[model samples]
Target: MKHWRGAVALTISSALVTGPAVQVRANPTAVPAVAVCVASVGCVVTVVAIAGVTYWVLSNNGQELRIPVLSYTPTPDQQLEDWEDYVWADNEQQARRKCNLLAEQYTNQGGSLVTVVRVRRASQRGSRWACTFRG
Candidate 1:
């Protein structure tokens, strides 16, 4: 708008300079009619320009930019809950079978069977299996 203001100033300066009523004012007491007409026209133009600028500014001020919302769903591995389950098998063969069954269960629940080992139960007479899983 600096260029626009320059144009406005140029217009007003030209109007003041070119107004023929200045030459008609040969007597000191005479009022120049053409100069009043030019000045009034320039004032009207300035008022209109100011009004146009105010309208443009006000019309653009309230415009708002809206960004879309984003949503994410986790993968099966990430969706899996924490591991906290067990399996008990009496013999080695049964322990292996139970371990496989537990592995299947873990996979169904979105988990990975990381480790399974035989451990002796302190209060029991036989050996048992301990399984660990992760997701």
Candidate 2:
């Protein structure tokens, strides 16, 4: 009788453990309504934030840049009158140095034009002088 009782208890416990753990049900219509309300609120907040940012940006706009007035006339300091005139100095180092100096001289003499103009010789003789400007 004791062995029969133990076997019955084991069978009951095994049945309980193997039973369905989750209760499945049909989808509710109210869930969609709640999601729509939350989504609408989110959209409204997003629009208000965008409008506020745009207003702030427009209200605090920066000053416009004015054209620089040059105090001194622009002039080339170094002159090369040979085949090397057509070739640019080996790297950018020389060109940058010249540009900085030219820009300084221009700003010093009330010259509003703070620009550097590079003049290069053409491949052929009497060709129009090739020029480039940097600011």
Candidate 3:
């Protein structure tokens, strides 16, 4: 009786371990549907994430215009101090509009005599050059 029980257990365990192997051997080209679907979804998500990052890196989304302002001091010995204001916009016109808004805000806040020296547009590769304000 003991030998018979051991033989039965061995047969069941071997069948359980080799069942999938036998099926693969019978039809080697058959792929499971669930694996294919999961793989396809993973690939799609990866491709979309890569494309979005590439677009953001290659585009001029975060480009800014640097406006240099010379502030005059109201003291016995008047001094002129220079500062920069950065505005992010799509183009030069939009940047000028934003700069005008900033100038209004600054003037309303009791700021000193501020005069804009020039507008500098920063390139995507970090170089900056003078850009004319059309506003």
* RMSD after CA superposition, every candidate: 34.1, 32.6, 27.8
Using Cα atoms with residue i matched to residue i, what is each candidate's TM-score against the true structure?
0.28, 0.21, 0.33
lDDT of 3 by residue, 40-78 (tens): 422210000121121001112343222111112245465
lDDT score, residue 53, model 3?
Answer: 20
Backbone clashes for every candidate come to 0, 11, 0
What is the per-residue lDDT of model 1 for residues 9-77, given as tens digits with 9 covering 90 to 100? 222222323332111101111224312323442321111122112110111134422211111233535
lDDT, residue 75, candidate 2: 44
Winner on TM-score (1 vs 2):
1
lDDT of 2 at 58: 11
Better of 2 and 3 by lDDT: 3
Q: Given candidate 3, what's the lDDT at residue 29? A: 13
- The lDDT per prediction is 0.33, 0.29, 0.34
Superposed by TM-score, candidate 2 places the C-alpha of residue 110 at a distance from the truth, in angstroms, of: 3.3
| Best first by lDDT, ranked | 3, 1, 2
- lDDT per residue for candidate 2 within 1-135, as digits (tens), equals 011111211111222223432121211122343223224423210001121121000111232212111112224552212111222343355545554565666457744445445655444554333334432
- The list of candidate 2 runs beyond 4 A from truth reads 1-88, 116-131
Who wins the TM-score comparison? 3
